[model samples]
Each structure stands twice: as C-alpha cells, then as structure tokens.
Target: MRTSRDAPTRRIRAAVVGTGAIAAGSHLPALAALAAEGGLEVVAAVDVDTGAVQRFCADGGVPHGYTDLGRMLAEQRPDLVCICTPPTLHREQTVAALRAGAWVWCEKPPVPSLADFDAVEAEEGQEDDGGPYASIVFQHRFGSGARHVRRLIADGALGRPLVAHCQTTWYRDAAYYAVPWRGRWDTEGGGPAMGHGIHQTDLLLDLLGPWSEVRAMAGRLVHDVQTEDVSTALVRFGGGALATVVNSVLSPDEVSRIRIDCERATVELTHLYGHGNDNWRITPAPGVPAGEAAAWRDFGPDVPSSHLAQLRELVASMRAGQRPRSSGADGRTSLELVTALYKSAFTDTTVRAGDIGPGDPFYTALHGGAPGWAPAPATYEEASA
Candidate 1:
C-alpha cells in the first residue's frame, strides 16, 4: 500500500559541497529557483575553502556554511546533498552522503575511476526500498528536443538505427587550464575526452544504448596539461549501429553535434553548451514521407536541456521513493565508455564492452596504471593566467 511517505509535500532540505564555477553557475541558481517555489530549501553548503563557502552562502541566500563535509552532514541532516566537487573527491563525499541517509546529486565525470564509482554505488539503498540513492548530472538527456527524438526512435517512427557521428570540439586556451586541477590525470581525469566530451557522448549512449566495442586514440595536441587535448574513437553499438566520436579542446569554432542515420530518417542536433528545439533537425530518407520528418522536428514546448531540468526530475523522483534517471547504473555506461576509450588509446587495441573489469588496470586509473606525460612548460604569463 502506498503511504504519505511515498509523496512528500514537505520541502526537501538540501546542502551543497564544493563552491566552484559549476556550483555557482548551475546548481545554486537552479536550487535557488526551487527553493523560491517551496519545493527545496538550501540548508547548508560545504567547501574546503571557508571564504568561498561563506561568500557562496551569502550570495545565494543559503542559511549555513561549513568547511568540512562531515560537519555539514551531521549538523544539517539534509534530504538532498549535491556533490559539486572535483572528480577525485566525488567517491568519498557521495558515499558519505548516501550513508548519512541523503539522496545525492553529483556532477559529471562522477568519479575518476570505475572502481570509485562502484564504491559509491554500493552505499545506496537496494532496489525499491529507496530511502537514499544517487544520480549523476547528465542533463543532455533531459531536454525536450532529445526527448522527442528518443520517443520517435522507440516508436518505430525512425526505423532501424544505422550509423551516427558525435563531436565535442571546443577550445580551452592555456588560461583555462591555469587552474591547478584543470588538466592533470589525478585531478581532472582525462582532459577533453573525460571532462568536456563526456556530456554529448553520454547523450549519444543514452539514445543508442550499450556500445559493443571501441577503437580509439588520444594525444596532447596543444594544451600543456598532462591529459589529452584531443581524442577520436570508432564505436560499434549493441543495436548494430556504428559511430565515430571526436573530443577536442583545440577547435576554435566550438560545436556539439550528434547526427544519427536511421533507415527512415536522419536526425541531427547541433549546438554549443545548451540546446533548444531550433538546434535540432531531421531529414527523411529517400522515398520516406515528408510528414514524418516535419513531425520529428516539431518537439512541443521548448525546454532547453540544462542542469535545472535534470535537478527538478531528481527531486521529484526522490519524493516518489524512486531512483532517478542517470542513477549509478545508468551513469556507469558512459563512464565505462570513457574507460574503454582510454584503454584502447593507450594499449593500441580495440576494447570490448566487458574488457575492463576488476582485474584491469584501467578500472583503477584511466591511464592504465602507467605514468602520465609530464606537463609541458608554461610561459610565466600563461602560468599566472
């Protein structure tokens, strides 16, 4: 029997860890809006930098700030905890929150390695008994445009999936990596492929389902960071579709594009950062009806996919005692793809779906337990920038 506990009307008490750009720019604002509507309350914030946390709370109207995560968890007892810290810090913080009886919402590149992600996943409540669960911020999958096309594909309006291409080619100059954690393997994980490209590619995986194999290569083409600035991969999906993926921080004219060719039509979305209905287009294959193509592009009620969209869904799912989309299991798909890409690039071999597991070195580190390339020399201005 369903009870009142299944549909919470009481506002969700929330706390945020890490006061970085992503927290300030995306999470905080969305949370603030939700709080304004009486759906959530920003109870506390945690950051290693006390001053940053203080400023974040003051500016965002949060009630409390703490320098330590454990202290915040103990004192606030929040219903939802947002882990906005760097990838390296994600595992410990997420596990701590889940064990503390709070549902967690974490940023992308959820953890530095698959082992760490699994460790965090193990702490969550099992099955539907859900008092606590965690979700990764893969907002690209929540947009109405992507939602519309995904429906079309599922309904057989798009027919059999055939081939596809996805790209995350955006430039981040030396100044961008000047931050201490920007490019190191231990810190930011694996450069553009892990940090930047994972967003679009996660959406691709969401649309296409499980990938079967990947052949790839990565290199430090321009940036002085320890990780690669560019990477390219050829992927084979379980649904009998093929794809070419490219991740690069060296391109001047930035764009995020994904094009899928199906037996009935070709669907494409092109935009940088966030996307709207205008950014998506569809073309019917030869001899196919023109009306289907028009209906494909006619996504109703333009909801630009963003952090807020996903966050709203996460909160609602928690209220309903349900594990939200992009749960640990859902997120592992994209992270597994990242692991496979790194393994393939470094080993000079094609990597299969289950090739990387407990025994594999790539399971622990994206670099396969090998030492990474030394950071290139930076000019004084570049270093200071």
Candidate 2:
C-alpha cells in the first residue's frame, strides 16, 4: 500500500546533488526527458564546486545551483532529490533530503558502510505515512531484460535455479585511482566489488533471491590503494543454489555477465555497462517443449537499463507514497552481500546472511576497525600466519 500527502499523481519538484559526470551525463538527461512529459520539474542542483555547479545548471537549464545542500533543500523544497555524489557523502546528503521531506534516488555504493546506510534509513518516513525514503540507484535491475528474467524465475517458468555465475571484470589504471577517492576504503568504499561489480551482482541477487552464505578471497594484487583490486567468492543461495562471483579491476577484457543454470532452462546475460533485450539468451533443457523455450525468449520490449529507467519508477513511488523497489531492505541487501564478501575475504571465514550486526566489526566498517582505514587491516597472509 502507498500513502502520500498529495494526489496520486502530481507534478514534483526535483533537485540534483553533485554536478559531476554522472549528473551531467546520465541524470540530467533523464530528468529533462521526464520533465518534458510533465512528471517533475528540475528546480535545483547542488555541488561544492561553484563554477562546476553553475556551469552544470546553465547547461542543463536547471533554475537554481547551490553549493550547500541544506540551502538547496530550504530554497527549493523539492519533492525528489537525486543524489549523484560519492559514497562518503551519501548518508549525510540522503538524511538531509529526507529530513527536508523529499524522496531520494542516490547513486550506487549508497553509503560508505552498513552503519551509514542504517543512519540514513533511520531518517526516512514510514511508507504508510507518505515517506521521504532513500532509494539506491540500482538502475541495472530496471532493464526490461532483467525484469523479464525475474518474472520467469519467480513464476517457476525457468525451474529451480541450481547453479549461477556472476562476474564484473573491468580495468582501472593509476590515473583512475589518482582521483583520491577512487580506490580508498574511506571514500570509494571498496574495490570493484563495491564500486563496479555491485550492479551486476545486485542484478544477480535480484534474480536468485536470498543468499545464505559466502566464502570469499580478496587481495591487493595490482592496485597500491588501501582496498583489494580483485576478489572472488563462492555463494550459497537459500534455495540450495551454488554460485561463483568475481569482482576485478585488473582484467584486460572487460565485461559484466551473469549466467544461471536452472532445472529446466539456462539463462545468460552478457553486457558491459547496460543491456537490451538482445543481450539476454535462454535455452530450455532437452525434452522441454520448443514452444515453451520460444515463449521464454519473448521479452516484450527493449528498455535498456539507465538512470532514467529507475528514476521513472522512483518518481511514481514518491507520488504514490509507496515503498519503491531498491529502497530500505531491498537496497540494503546488496550492501550486506558486499560487506559479507569483504568480511569473508578478510577473515577467511564463511560469512552468513544476518551474521553482521551492531557488535560485529564488519557491521560498522568493511575493513573492520571503523568506517575508515584507521587501525589498518592485517594482510591476509599476516592473518593466516
């Protein structure tokens, strides 16, 4: 059920925080397209870079540009706040937006850690009370291909998922890490696992449902940064499925892929950043009706996953005062998996779902001391020794 203070469908005012590449490249265009359709107005944008924010607003034709988020919220009182900032700033920015009575659509790696995620979650209004909730931008899940696959998996059309593989293998060099926040525990959160591969794995979990346990390994194989550049894990899903996951920033050939072998059929999606219907393939097991396999391949239309795809659904959820997909528990689930992956990697233990809590070192910090790299984590070898 959804509850809202206003009519079921009304024009909403929106503000964009962080006028960086993501804001200029992805979010602004989506907002503009939606604005033209009379869904919302892009009233303001916020960023610490004065010149950049001004140029962004001028180029995007947003009415107001402010460096201070508090100022923007006070001035615009937007119904929706689209946060395109770094992981570190997400918690504070989202909490502020929710307190100002706005729904949030934040960029991925939503907060630095689970504790930060929980802090932002605390400030959100109840869905039954016409909330101002914060939703992580997991745009990958919004694509038509994923939606179609999820429907098939849920309906048992694909039969029980027995085996799966999820991998996010990409390359990032020294220049990319030179940004200061790109490869650090305190700022960017983690390596490709939290930063790059999260989208693909989140989509994996979206299809496979709950994961029961994970045993993982991560190392700083190439990067000189505080976090690992590559990691691998074996996961057990609640329904008795086993999977392997790899997150790496050292691969020469780049790809984002997920393949699931179910009891009756096999499904695969291969794409780099975003995917369309053509990227997906389904093969029914032998003896299954050929017509059934054809029906499984029928994805209605091609909606490539994008910031726009998620923003559209988020806006509708805000207007209807409903708990949108990828918010609250749904949003937190992927973060938990990442955290568990890290915990399992660092501690050499098989971490289970619901294992990390207030007292758990991993609950508040991925590196297990505090949110940042404070006490300094022992090397995996040192821990083993």
Top candidate when judged by TM-score against the true structure: 2
Q: Residue 294 lDDT in model 2? A: 89
Model 2, 1-385: lDDT tens per residue? 1224576667788899999999999999999999999977899999999999999999999989999999888878888899999988898889888998888889998887898988899998975697878899999999799999999999999899999999999998989999978887788888899999999989999999999999999888887888889999999999999999999999999999999999999999999999999999998899999898889999997999999999888887876778899999999999999999999888889999999989888888788753333346679999999
Clashing pairs for model 2 are: none
What's the lDDT for residue 299 in model 1? 96
TM-score of each model, paired residue for residue:
0.94, 0.95
lDDT of 1 by residue, 1-385 (tens): 2211455898898899999899999999989889999998999999999899999999999999999899888888888999999998999999899888888999988899888888888888866676588899999999799899889887888898999999999999889999999899788877888999999999999988899999999988787778889999999999999999999999999999999999988889999998988998988888876775677778999999998899889888888888789986787899999989989988889999988889898998888865454344579999899
Clashes of each: 0, 0
* Per-candidate local distance difference test: 0.88, 0.89
